[model samples]
Target: MFKSLWLQTAYSRDPYPALDQDVTCDICIIGGGLAGIANAYYLAKEGKDVILVEKDTILAGATGNSTGKLTAQHDFVYAKLLKQFGLDQAKLYYGVNEQAIEFARSFAKEGEIKAADSILYSQTKHGTELLRHEMRAYETLGIPGELGKNSELPIHIDATLTMPNESQIHPVRFGQHLAQLAVEAGARIYEHSDVVLMDLKKRLLAMKSGHEIQFTELILCTHYPIEALRGLQVMKLAVDRSYIVAAEGNMPLQGQYISVDSPKRSIRTAQFDDKTFFLLSGESHTAGAESNTEVHYKRLNTDVQELYHLDTLTNRWSAQDPQTPDLIPYAGIISSSMPYVYLSTGNRKWGLSNSLANARIISDLIVGRDNNASQLYAPDRTGFGSFLLQALKISGLVVTEFTGGHLTRTNAPICTHMGCRTRWNEGDETWDCPCHGSRFRKDGSVLEGPATKPLNLK
Candidate 1:
C-alpha cells in the first residue's frame, strides 16, 4: 500500500471487508483514489446502488501521497495551451479546474485553503520571460493574476506569476472524508478487492478472491487504469515520477510557489500537529529512467537546505502521474474494445483539480446526460503529431532496453505490459518499466500497472 506524510499525519482505519459474495449493483466503481471516491459521491447522491471496490485501502495510492493544490495554474501550461489550442480551449480548461476547486471547497476541511493564490517564480531571465508570457495568457483568459518580483522569499526571484484563487487541502483527510460521505449516502465500499479480469459481454468483474461482481456499469478510475484487457493504454500515456520531502522548518513562506525552470521545485506549506511543514517537491523523470532514484531525494534535500535553510527533513516520498500525448487528460469511454467501460486518468501531477473534473464528466456520461466538458476530454480524441512524437520516443526506449536485455539478461524481471525488460528502482525497491511505468515489487508482485499481472518469476 501507499504511505506518505499525509497518511503518516492522518490516522489509519481498519480495511473495508473484502467482497465475500456476489454483488449486483447499478454501478461498480473500481479504484479507491480521488476519482473513484468522487464518482461514488456523485452516483450515490443520485440514489444509485454504487459498489466501489479498491485493490488496497482508500487513500493508499496517489491520493495519500499527493501535495494537494487545487489550481488551474498548471506550471504555465495555460500559456502553451493558449498558443497551441487557442483562447477557447485554454479558457475551458481553466474554468473546469476552478470548478473542481469549488467542488472541493464545499466539503474540504476547515484548515484547508480555499481560493488561495498560487505563485510561480522564476530564477532565470529566460524563465522570467516565460512567466511574463504566462501572465499575458492569464489575462487573455480573464484569469485573475499578477506579475511582479517576490522579494520576500528566502531565495531570489527575478520574476513571478501569481494565479489568483487557487486552493490547497490535506489530501488524505479530504479523501477519507469523501469515502465516509459516500458511504453515508448509501454507497458500499470494499477494500482488498483486486479485479483480475473483466468480461464486458457478461458484465462481470472477476476478483483475485474468486468472487464476482455484476454491474450494469464500470468505471476504471484507478491511477493507472487496470488493463486486464488489452486496452493499449501504454501507447496513450507516459509516466513522470517526482520526489517530495516534507519537513518542519523555522522558515515559513506565504503563497504556494512553483518554479518555471527545469528540475522543477514546487513549494507549499502544510500544518500538522500544530507545526507548519515545508513540502519541497521536484526532480521529475520518467519512472525507472534513473538508475539511482535515491539521488533525486538527496538532491532535493540539499536544495531545500540551501534555499530554505531547513535542516530538519522528516519525511521523504515519491508519486507518479501520467501525461497523454496531447497534454490533455483522458476522461471518457475507456476504449472501443470495451464500450461499456469508462475511465478517468492521466492526471499528470494535477490530480487535485483534474480528478474532480474527470469525476463530474464521467458521472454525467454514466447517467447518459449531455456533459458540456465531454468534447475536450474525449478519450478517443487524437493529436496525430503528438501521438507520433510520443510513439517514436517510447519505441526507441522500448527497443533499446529489450535489445540490450537479450544479450545480458538471463531471466531478469521483464515488464508484463509489452515484455520490455524492467529496471530496478533503487530508492523504492521496485522494478519499473521505462516503456510504460508499470511497477513491480522485487518479488514480482504488481505495484502499479498498465500490466495487470505480476511478472513471471522464472
Candidate 2:
C-alpha cells in the first residue's frame, strides 16, 4: 500500500478493479501503467481487441509516483550510448524517445488529453561539464541544444543546459485519460487482476482469483514480469528505489533539474489550486536493499527547508524502476522460444519517455511494421563487454547475499525472485524485500507488496 500522504492526494482518488472472470482478447497486457495503457491505446486504435490486467489500480505503480518529466534527455546517457552501442544505435535510441515526447505533446495539443505541462530544463554546477560533453555528442548527431548561465530558477548554479521542448504532466491523469481512450477504442481493462501463473507453453495466464486469460500474443508490461523467461529478466535488470517530497512553497522551483552527483536529486514544480508546489526527488538506492530510507527522506526534507524555506510537506512517495546494466531499456519480443510474448522493462527512471517509445516500437513489431527502434531495444541482443559486466555484477550480488554479513543475521531470511537468498533489512523488518521490495512478514505474509505474493519456499 502507498503512504498516507500520497493516498490522500489527488492522484490516488480513483481506483480500478482487477480482472475477476475468464476472458480472451487479441492482446493481453499485464500491467496498467503508462507502458501497458499506451500500448493498449495504440493497439485498440488499430482495431485490435486488447485486454489490460493490473494487479492493483491503473497507474498505481511507478507511473503514479513519477515526477512526470517528459523529455528525451536521459541523464548524460547519449555519450555512454554512443560509446557502447555505436552512434547509429545511439541515434535510434534518441530518435525514438524524441518521437515519444512529440507524441505526448501532440496528444495533449489535440485536446485528446489535458495539456502537458512545460518545464524549463536546467542542470546543476556539477553537471555543467557533462552538459558540454552531451551538447558535443548531440551536435555530432545534428541535434540542437544550448548552454545557459542564467535560468528562471531562484537557486544559483554555475551553468546549465536547457532543452526547450521538454515537458511534464500529471502522470496519473494522463494514464486515466489513456485508459478511457483505450476503453472507447474497444479495449477492456481489468484491475486487481493479478497474474499469478503464466503457462508459456500453453499461452495461458492464471489469475489470482482462479480466472485465466488466453491470448495469441502477450505483453509483459508489469514493471517486473512474474514469469522468468529466457535470459533471466530478474538477474538482467537491477531494481533501484527513489524517494520524493512535494510541498507548498514561497515560490516554486522554476525548472526541471537533475544532479550530476550520486543520490541524484531532481527538482521541479507543480500547481495545485492557487498554490504552487515544489517537488524534490532523489535518495535513490537498490530496491528493498536500502540501508536508510527514512534517513533519506529526512535528508530530502532538510534540503527542501534549506533551499526554499518551505515547511509544508504535503506528499511523499517512493518508486522502484528496473535499471539495465548498460542503461538502455530492453524492449521487443522476448526470444524465439517465446515469439508471441513481448516484454518492455528496464527503463531505469525514465519511464515517461521510454514507456511511450516502447509502446511505439512494440506495436510496430506486433503489427509487422518495419521499425529500427525495435532492433535497438531487442532483449536477446548482447555484446562481450556488457555481457561480462552483467554477469559479474549479478554473480557478485548473489555471492554476497550468501557469504556476506548482510544476509547471515537477518531477522527474516532474504531471497531474490530467482530463489537466491537476499540480505536482510533491520530497519524495514520485512526481509529488506529484495528483488524489488516484494516484502514479506516473518510468517511470509506480504507487507510491501510490489511482488503480488510471497516467495515460494522450495
Candidate 3:
C-alpha cells in the first residue's frame, strides 16, 4: 500500500557510485531530488563544473513520491498571494511557475510529460467565494483562466477555475532525463553519498564514505535544508505530509484537479505498464501529527471507492513538503553571511514546478544573471506582519510539542534536530519528529532532515 506509482515505473539505470575520493568543483549541490538535478542541469549547461551528492538514489525523496502536477494554479493561491505579497510579487510567482512548466515541456521526452489543463474547484459556498477571489486575482494578473460549473470529475463541484496548457509528467522519468542531460553537460552525480560533515566557511563537505568535496559555491536542494546555517529555517518552515493512492481503473479525469475545500482532494490520471490508473490524493497533516498514519490511506481508499468505484488499489504513498509562513518558497541564498551557499525549499506540495523555478533562480544567481524572481523566494526575507504572527504561532507549537514530547512516557527516541521525541508513523513505519519534521528509519538511520544525524537508539 505504501508503494509510489512513480517510483514503481521509475526510469531505471545502474546506480551511480558513491564519492570515492576528494574532489574540487566550481559548484557542489546537495540532495538528488528534482531540485538538485534541475540545478545541475542548468548550471552544467552554462559550462560550470558541478558535483551533486545524494544520500540515496536520485528522485527517491519527494520527487519519486510526487503526483508530478506542473501548473501555476496551485489550489486557489493567487488570491492569497495577491492579498499578502501584493500584485507584482503575485504576478511574478505565476510567471515563474509558468516558465518552469514551459521548461518541463521543452525538456521532457514525448510521453514523459504530457500536456493537460489544470483545474481548482470548490464544493462549499465559502470555497466558491475563494475561487471567485482567485478568479479576480487571475484576471488582474493577466493569467488565462475561466470559471466553470462542471469538469470530468465524478464528484460534484460548486465552482472551478480552469487554467489551460498546464502539464503533468512522470516525475521519476523526467528527473532521470534531467540527470542524463546534466551528465551530458559535464555534471557529476553520486548516489548513496551522505554528507556527514560540512564547513560552510571553508566551503568544504565530507561525505559518509570519508571523501571530501571542496567547492566555491554550495547549493542545498534537500527537501529540507539539512544545514540550518544561520537562517533558522527549522523555525521558519513547517513540514506537511500528504497521502496519495493510485487505483487501477480505465476511467480518467479530464485534467489535473484539486479542491479548495477542506480535506483537499487532488485528482489526476496515469498510465503504467499499459494499464490506466487514477491518482486520488489529499488528507494533509503535519508530518508527525498523526500517529496511526494508516488511517489516512484508509480514508483515501474509501474516497476512491465511493467516487471512482475503483476497488483494485494499485499503490499508496505519501510525500513531505516544507511550508513557509507566507506560503512562498525559500529558494535563493541561505543568508547574507553565507554568500556562496544557496538553498531551495518550502514549495508546499507543488514541488514539480517550484523546484524547477527555484533551480532556475539559483542558477541565475550563481552565474551572475539578473533574475527578477530572486527576492520573492529569498530565505533571508523578513516575514510580513501577518506572516510574522503565523511564524510565531508555528514556533509556539514547536515549543508545546517539545515540552509535551519530553513529558510523555514512551520508548521513542529523541529527534536529533531539536531533541523532540519521535512518533512512530504506522503507515510509513518511520520515526517522525513533531517539532521540526525530522524522520528516521526503523534502524535509527535518518530518512529526512533537519535531522542530519541518525537517532541513537541506545
Candidate 4:
C-alpha cells in the first residue's frame, strides 16, 4: 500500500557503484533527484567535470513519489505572486515555468510525456473569488488561460480556471533518462553514497562509506540543506507532507484537476500495463506534526471509494516538500561571500517545473550567463512584509517545538538536526522531527536530513 506508482513502472537501470576512493571534480551535486540530475545534465553537457552522489537509488526520493503534474497553474498562485512580486516579476515566474515544461518536451521519450490542460476548480464562494482574481492575473501576465463555470469532473463546482499548454509525465522515467544523458555527457553518478559530513572551508564531503569528494563547486539539492547555516534556512522554510493513492479506474479527466476549496483535492490519471489508474492526492500537513499519519491515507481511501467507487487501490505513498516564506524557491549562490556554493530548495510541492528552473538558474550562474531569475530566487532575498510574517510563523513553530520537546518525557531519541524530540510516524514507520523535519528509520539511521548523523541509540 505504501508503494509509489511511478516506481512500479517497468523502467529500470543498473545501479551506479559507491565512491571507492578519494576523488576530485569541478562540481559535486549532493542529491540525485530531478534538480541534481537536471543540473548535472546541463553542466556536464557544457563540459564541466561533475559528480553526483545519492544516499539511495535515483528517483527513490520525492521525485519518484511525486504526483508528476507539470504545469504553471500552481493552484491559485498567480494572483498571490502578482501581488507579492509585481507585474514584471510575476510574468517572468510564469514564463520560466512554461519554459521548463518545454525543456522536458525537448528530450521526453514517447509516452513518457503527455499533454494536458491544468484545471483549478472551486466549490466554495471564497474559492471562486480566488479563481476570478487569478484569471485576471493570468490576463495581466499575458498567459493563456480562461475562466469557466463547468468542468468534466463529477463533482460540482462554482468556477473553474483552465490553463492550456500544461503537461504530465512519468517523472521517475524522465529523471532516469536525464541521469543517463548526464552520464553520457561525462557526469559521474554514484548510488549508496551517503554524505554524513561536510567541511565547507576545505570544500570536502565525507561519506559514511569512508570515501571523500573534493570539489571546486558544490550544490545541495537534498531538499533540505545538510547544514542549518545558523538556522537561517530552517527559519525561512517549513516542511509539508502530502499523501497520494492510485486506484483502478477509467480516465475521468481529460486534463489534470485540483480544487481551491477546503480539503483540497488533486486528480490525474495515467495508463500503464494496459490499465488506467486515477491518482488522488491531498491531505497535506506539516511533517511530524501528526501522531497517527495513517488517518490521512484512510481519509483519501474513503473519499475515492465514495466518489469514484474505485474499490481497488494499487499504490499509496507520501512526499515531503520544503515550502518557503514567499512561495518562491531559494536558488543560485548561497551567499555573495560564498560564491562557490550553490543550492536549490523550497519548491513548495511544485518541484517538476521548479526543479528545471533551478537547474537553469544555477547552470547559467556557473557558466557566466545572464539570467534575470537569479535575482528573483536568490537565497538571500528578503525584507518583504508578507515574507517576514511567514518567517516569524516558522520561528514561532521552532520555539514551541523546543519548549514541547523538553516537556515530553519519552525514551525517544532527540533529533540530530535540532534538539526536538522524535515522534514515531505509524504510516511511514519512521521517526520524524517536528522542529526541522529530519526522518530516521526504526533502527535510527538517518532517512532524511538536515540531520546527517544517525541516532545515537545504544
Model 4, runs deviating above 4 Å: none
- Judging by lDDT, tell me the better candidate of 1 and 4: 4
Ranking by TM-score: 3, 4, 1, 2
Q: What does the lDDT come to for candidate 1?
A: 0.81
TM-scores for all candidates: the values are 0.94, 0.89, 0.98, 0.97
lDDT of 2 by residue, 1-458 (tens): 22422234443344555677788889999988899999999899888999998876777677888887887777777778888888898888889998987888766522123232232233455567777777788777766567666455556566666655577766776667778878899999887777778898888999889999999899989766775678776667777878888888767544577766555778877655467768888888877666556787789899888877889888877777888777788888988788899999889999988999999888988888888888778877666374677756865665565555344544434453444344444334445555444555555554334455665444
Worst 10 residues of 3 by lDDT: 223-232
Ranking by lDDT: 3, 4, 1, 2
Q: lDDT at 37 for candidate 2?
A: 95
Winner by TM-score between candidate 3 and candidate 1: 3
Displacement of residue 339 (Cα, Å) in model 1 is 3.6
> Which residue pairs does candidate 3 place in steric collision?
none
lDDT of 2: 0.73
Model 3 Cα shift for residue 3 (angstroms): 1.9
Candidate 1's residue-wise lDDT over 137-165, tens digit each? 88899998899985457787888888766
- Backbone collisions counted per model: 0, 5, 0, 0
TM-score of 1: 0.94
Error of 1 at 62 (Å): 1.6
lDDT of 4 by residue, 301-384 (tens): 998898878988999998998988888998888877788889899999999999999999999999999999999988877665
Q: What does candidate 3's lDDT look like per residue over 1-458, in tens digits?
A: 66799888886688988899999999999999999999999999999999999997889899999888988888878888988889999999999999999998887896588878899899999999888888899999999999887588878889988998799989999899999999999999999888988898788998888889999999999876776678787678888999999988888666899999988889999865688889989989988877899999999999999878889998999989989988899898998988999989999999999999999999999999999999998999875677788778778878888888788836789999878889989999899998888889999999888788899999
